[model samples]
Target: MKMNICMVGALLLLGVAASGCANNRDLIAKSVIPARNDVFTEGGNGAQAGRAVVDFTLLVKSNLYYLMGTYGKHTAPPYRAHLNIDGQTTILEADPILEDNNSVGLKAPESGTGWKYQFSKRLTLAPGKHRLSIALPIDDVIVEREIEIRPGINTVAVTPVYKRKMLRPYKGENFSAGVKTVEIAVN
Candidate 1:
């Protein structure tokens, strides 16, 4: 009789444990359903869905000697940068130019000025490759590149630096003819 009672008790305990697991499974499913609703869609069709973000920074290079010899001071003129994402163009106005007066960091050369500006935007891109075009209207320069945006954070750096060779004097003049060039870097 004791053995039969123990078997009945074990079966009851097993039934309780199985029911608990079923409740836990339902709880897990309920928790995930709301999170799945927050997914971002890149296109109208239900093709691509996920969260995508992009961080972009702009760095402008300046030569201290060139500025001192030519203009006697470092200056950064305001310019606008435009980004084309998936055939959509967005304009980003340049912040007021700032000259770095502090000591140079180890990564930078000591003789030059690093005029920097930055902007960021979160993108809802499809889960595949896309075309991105960056345009600096001040210099009339545009760079077209393809990038694959995954379901996480992506970083990009756009460096616009004037080439020293482009500033040569024209027709034996002491001052150089006004010329500007942009160098782009992507990361």
Candidate 2:
């Protein structure tokens, strides 16, 4: 009799755990549902009509750099990013211009002496709360945050920074550590 009772108890616990997992899965699915309407419109056409304008910029170092002869000619790999806002995903590619340490305002030794790629987008969105996500698949960098878009023009800047341990006296400009922190600023 005791053996049968223990088996029943274990079965009951397993059923409850399974049901809890199902509930969590349902919640996750609901949260990721795509937006019903296309919210991100390019350019500033609707800004005066009450839509908010957002100028977004993303800057990151190229994954690989080559030294040509002794001049150290740097080349930028084709960098692409996936940006998701309000459950809608958009793909963005870096601009043709490749900036160096001089234009980026970073010291050579500290900045890794690499070419930087930049991506910019001007978007018009409804003024309200938004969920923003950025993923750089090649660089293995992902950032997600909640942003409030107010009326008029807004500037959003996203840039990758060296890991804490990789900076300063320890060792600066080390790409081996990869990008651990991405700084986001909205103005």
Candidate 3:
């Protein structure tokens, strides 16, 4: 009789524990990742030039030299930089243009910043502050920045830089074409 009572008590405890775990299986949501993917998508030359202007702004702040905004979504890493020395604005091209894509070039022997340029004899930048005007490649947005030059060794931190990804074209297609939701049980 005592053994039977003990069995009943153990069963009751086991059932209570099982039920507690089952109730918790509803998911208490330890962390909710509310992440949003904000993007920009437009087509045409006007749109591209607009992108170049946007990229020029974010590039200089952190050091990557060329930051991409929403407008630079169409092409694979698109941007051309132009620096205004005094009153002259010179267009700089990527070195080995096709090889590096200058898309990721961050070397400027002159200003020591970044420009789509080849370091041919340590470039030239007069003492003072200069303006940068970047061109959009493949219809990219433009972002502008200002750089200061002083005669001597200068260093800038350019990290956390991101490469631009092509904006996927939007078409009226079924988003849930073949997606199915199913659940299975494991023992």
Model 3 lDDT, residue 75, Cα: 27
Off by over 4 Å in 2: 1-37, 65-77, 96-112, 164-169, 173-177
The lDDT values for all models are: 0.48, 0.65, 0.29
Cα error, residue 125 of model 3, in Å, equals 2.9
Which pairs in model 2 have colliding backbones?
none
How displaced is residue 40 in candidate 1, in Å?
Answer: 10
Q: Give per-model TM-scores.
A: 0.49, 0.64, 0.27
Top-lDDT structure, candidate number: 2
Least lDDT summed over 10 consecutive residues: which range in candidate 3? 178-187
Candidate 2 per-residue lDDT, tens place, 1-187, comes to 9999999999999999777544333433343345544878777755666689999898666535355622222234356766778877666676534334544434333344445567888888898999887766555566779999999899999877754333453545543344555678888
Q: Highest TM-score: give the candidate number.
A: 2
Residue-by-residue lDDT tens digits, candidate 3, 1-187 = 9999999999999999777544322221211111221222211222232132111111221122234631111124433333332334433334322122234332321122222223111233333454433322222223335655444322222111222222422322111111011111111
Which residue pairs clash in candidate 1? none
Worst 10 residues of 2 by lDDT: 69-78
RMSD (Cα, Å) for all candidates, in order, is 26.1, 11.1, 23.1
Best first by lDDT, ranked: 2, 1, 3
Per-residue error (Å), model 1, residue 160: 2.6
At residue 158, candidate 1 shows an lDDT of 68
